[model samples]
Target: MSGQAARNVLWIMCDQLRWDYLSCYGHPRLRTPNIDRLAAEGVRFDNAFVQGPVCGPSRMSYYTGRYVTSHGAVWNFVPMSVGEMTLGDYLRPLGVRVAVAGKTHIEADRTGMQRLGIDPASAAGVLAAEGGFEPYDRDDGIWPPGFSDESHRYTQYLRKQGYGGANPWHDHANSALGASGEILSGWNMRYAGLPARVDEADAETPYMTRRAIEFIEQSGEQPWVLHLSYIKPHWPYVAPAPYHAMYSIDDVLAAKRVPRELENAHPVLQGFRQAEVSRNFSCDHVRETVVPTYMGLIKQVDDQLGVLFDYLRRSGRDQDTMVIFCSDHGDYLGDHYLGEKELFHDCVTKVPLIIRLPGAGARRGAVESRLVEAIDLVPTILDAMGADIPDHILEGRSLLPLLRGAQPAGWRPAVFSENNYAFRDFVREPLGRPADGCHTIMVRDHEWKYVHFEGLRPQLFNLRADPEEFDDLGADPAHAPIRERYQTMLFDWLRNRKIHPTVSHAAMTEWTRKEESAGIHIGRW
Candidate 1:
């Protein structure tokens, strides 16, 4: 193994990309050669899971090296507390500049910032507002007709490209041209089979790839971390011509579901099952039409990644840069009779994680089965760059040691995920639960997956026996001991979570030592 330090980190994140969609992870049809190349040259983690299933909370966990519970940004559009320290805040002090090229899904803590006397337009305030990243170009990638904002860089770029409309994103980029030249908006799932009007080069994936390349070319010799986040393979599932027609219904895999799952579903699960997205996806025609388009979007992203990887090797950046490929969370794609994520199923909670360490390492091409979480990435990046991971603030363990061919002592036995569904209509209307009582926690170990919902019946699955999670033993009296064991584990995990971010373990130790030396222990006397 080479002793050379990593000079830069290329953190590539894809939105709503399932772990099983890529060929590297054994997708039978959707071949992702570039990502497969990464897996072949690096370590592939088979048991990685997100701390949250939604974009905002999951990404917050990734950026801050903390759980969703710790950050308190439990759902989308929910602002994290202003005092939360992120990867950029930790890395910048160590001379590693952090920048983002695409969507972060981070909403600013405006009130918190204002109360702290920070002007929103100021540089310090901007960094705080963007979840501690220097935004090269930030776009969340969903722009419907009435919801379109012309101020968005992508929208402006589309307008410049002769996509004349009030909302170019919805008109051209996300829409298709019919036989009579009428516009077919991608907002409707029925139109998902049509090719987008925009060219492949001008699409969102390629646009973000170009931005990433520009940032890399402009970063002259400075050690940096560039988060090239791609908002693709998400909703409004439309791809450009070549990619759009790449796959057909035959290429789409069978949806993993069963009639048994619907027989006696848990109350919270029933609430999610009642969602429009879930209901629509449950139809055979919907899955048959939409899934192929979803595959096309994923194929487009893989092609763009091929372009990006080629640029890295050509520029000689591959020699000294660590390239990490991962997603925030997986999309259900009609799995488990669900469409979008926001559940504890493996299809939604588990995600793809491949880390290509710079130079050489002993563990190349290895497959790690240990339970890892999204929060571990920041610590891993900090570890690679020789920076201190603040123990009080960052709770996740670094994966650098594992990359170096050794396992860390006391590795966690299970991974945890959480969700706050109070914002959804199903929770409020159908479930009749209070907003504050809509919280749910999932604990998944080697054999059993346990979910504890607030004021609702628990859900349990024996992964060893029922790997597909079709059987629910939550109400079975025979599984009482297993549920109790996992419940205790969850309680212990919550009790040990780091709450005081301002106080470090080292600082507390030093304070105790000083007090002992000064003979200031009032209780001892």
Candidate 2:
């Protein structure tokens, strides 16, 4: 480790936040000064993308530093395989205390734990149950009618704050008092403009930020990594007072769509277009009503970050703690005529990634336009901590070289992301595809983007010509060569995925061509 290397890491992650919405990323209306400050004092990546478009799969990739297929968590509510190693698994053994403050969207592998006879109360089992992080205060933030049980921490906290109801999360936190004195559910787009009943200080974002601050204060002098994950700027998009009224339809960006996208759309895309959220977002009124609140939620998140960053500075932890701010995935916000994130578009796939490395060895106020993925963060954190990266397990390269202002040789050319739409009603009813066959992969380089579906027609976009990706040329014969080349690249990527995580690359190298010397040779050599 270098003398000036950061001693701790504060990995702050927001859910469903777009890359372009931040002021640092050129948003004209919504100014995120705190996040912009981080970018000014650090490195802001222009082309960072997540491995999956949805919450569960995208967050799984971020936590484990592996692609969605590699981690075996293909969709929401799907538990990652028990054998997968996460950032906590890698860092805890190195004497770094790893903890999480908010949402991870990780479903526990209970069946695997039971099969292996792992006690749920044991330390090893606890770590495995929570996707390797020690949960200081974990809340996924999606509370439906019957889902919010007594054990839900956030609901309990809300109730303690004098908000009483069977489901306080739904009634108070994600709801608003309408003009007629009726409770307006945040789930309804019509009520998005209403301010939530909860106070701004007690909102989900502020509560999670407070929890993160508590974790940091409790950690003391120990070297640690805190995954301060926020659940807001996601669905149930109602912001508390002040923030809810901060912006209106005037500040909402125009929905990026055209008539050509609806014509002869891919079969899978057709299913998505028929979805309720997509149809709702396709309406001009719905976009005007809902997007303002979405913007407000993002602004609130930025303000809370300001609070968190100020605390770090006041506590003097800013000197040796690395601060990384990013989102799990981007929200569609009616982009390309789609709502919520499931398809591969720049609005859904690209995320804002800003890293403020500690001390003099780190680069400051730099912008890197290289194609980087969510999987790259685990190795980056390890590299920053001076820990050896296990190449056999982690499939991402460290960005430490880039942070130090040096270009690493053999950097990736094209970034990859995948999606599984089997869980959606659209995939089941409209597409009529089996669960296993609903997979899709996207590969993109500097000038071109290609989407390959399992049983559907491919999609090709010349990003240089149509940066908004309004036009598709997958069927055009002139672009056939480009599509074929990108398909080949995707195939190569899949074929070379590191499947054997149990053994090290160094061990395999030592055993190669020396198998006969170490053990019995195959075919009786």
Candidate 3:
């Protein structure tokens, strides 16, 4: 051990990597020894969930320690409103420098920046716009012709490497070359079998890993929080050499589904399955080609994790740095006949949460099965850095007690997740329901999972008996009591989401006592 307290944080998040794909998570074929090592040494949370199922909103929840509703950026490409306190806002006050590299999926709050008279192009404004993380290198990973509509450092690097096409991101990292020398872009799911036109090291995963290592090595005289976000395992499912051919179709696990999920499916599920994007993975041909490539991209990530962990240890930072590994959300990958992450299912909601605190052999290798959410990470990071948690700003509780092998009383009975599918174009006119009526809320406990769509029949699964979620018991007469219980739970959960406080209760009480001094009588009003 470095004999110092945990003064630094290495927050690593991978895009769209599912929890079950790791061998430590019980996958038989996928061997992620590097991530497994982190699990072996750190505390692993078995039931952590993301607040949203997609990229931008999920990342917003993670960075702000708040729910999607509280953050108000409920979908992709939407900027989180400025003045919504972020980890940077919380940590920087205590002298912790939070530096970020790789993707944040953040769209700058142009309106707020303008209103506040902050220059959007300035470094300070950029950091504030991106959840307050100082950029070691800010690469949103979506370049030219993608969601971001901009060029990134990775694209520039590709140009320097003589892959000088007009769209290097597509040609080098996201596309494959045809025998006729045509470019088969990986964006098309059918072309996933093709390998990217780059070497393993030049790939997005390795490039980001190298940049994170550089940031750590360049740190000077300050405790820092480095958000090392990786954009692989979430994509145009092609991987570079070695990783592309690392896994075969035989290694792909059989998609978990029962014929009954399609029979009398909830309107929400039916709508998702019929969407243009979801239809691609409905058949065997696409799944057979795409799933293997997805697995390979994950393998590449695992290999890079091995690299980063080794570097941390070699630099003696491993003993003093708190290492956290998680994902924004999981990909469905044909689960429930759905390809992308939408609708409420364990396939899309549940993600891996592993944390290795500083110092060796301190509650190492313990697993906590309690319900935790992605929103809890910011508070936990703040706690680990010895900073006071600003409870009024963050909606999550810290995991420090659990990390020390102590379970606090009054722990939550269930975890909650939500999706606002109402605004999506596919569901705009199909269901004839109000836009708000297309939203869904998920409440999951140890034994049961309930999903309630705004204006449709709810779906329920007794996870104790059917862990794979094959059958829906929402409409069963015998399960009415169970359904009602969870329904009430969801209602209360929404009705009682923590109200952001302008002043603490004690402060309010103290001020009320001096109301007469200020010429305002409390009760008379």
lDDT of 1: 0.89
lDDT-better candidate, 1 vs 3 = 1
Scored by lDDT, model 2 comes in at 0.89
Which residue segments of model 2 deviate by more than 4 Å? 1-4, 512-525
TM-score of candidate 2 against the unseen true structure = 0.97
RMSD of each: 1.9, 1.7, 2.4
- Please give the lDDT score at residue 272 for candidate 1: 81
Which tens-of-lDDT digit does each residue in 35-57 have in candidate 3? 99999888998999999898988
lDDT of 2 by residue, 299-389 (tens): 9999999999999999999998999999988877788888898899999999999999988877899999999999999999998888888
**Count of steric clashes across candidates, in order:** 0, 0, 0
In the range 1-525, model 1's lDDT, one tens digit per residue, is: 123358899999999999999998999999899999999888999999999999999999999999988999999999999999999999887777799988899999999999999999999999999999998788887556677776688888888888887677888888898899889988788888888999989999999999899999999888889999988888888888888888888998899999989998887777787889899999988988898888899888888889999999999999989999999999888888888999999998999999999775546788999999999999998888888878888889989988888857899999999999899976566878889998999999889999999887789999999999999899999999999999999999999889999988888879978888898886873
For residue 215, give model 1's deviation from the true position in Å. Answer: 0.3
After superposition, the stretches of candidate 1 with alpha carbons farther than 4 Å from their true spots are 1-4, 515-525
Candidate 3 stretches with Cα past 4 Å from truth are 1-5, 143-151, 514-525
CA displacement after TM-score superposition, residue 46 of candidate 1 (Å):
0.3
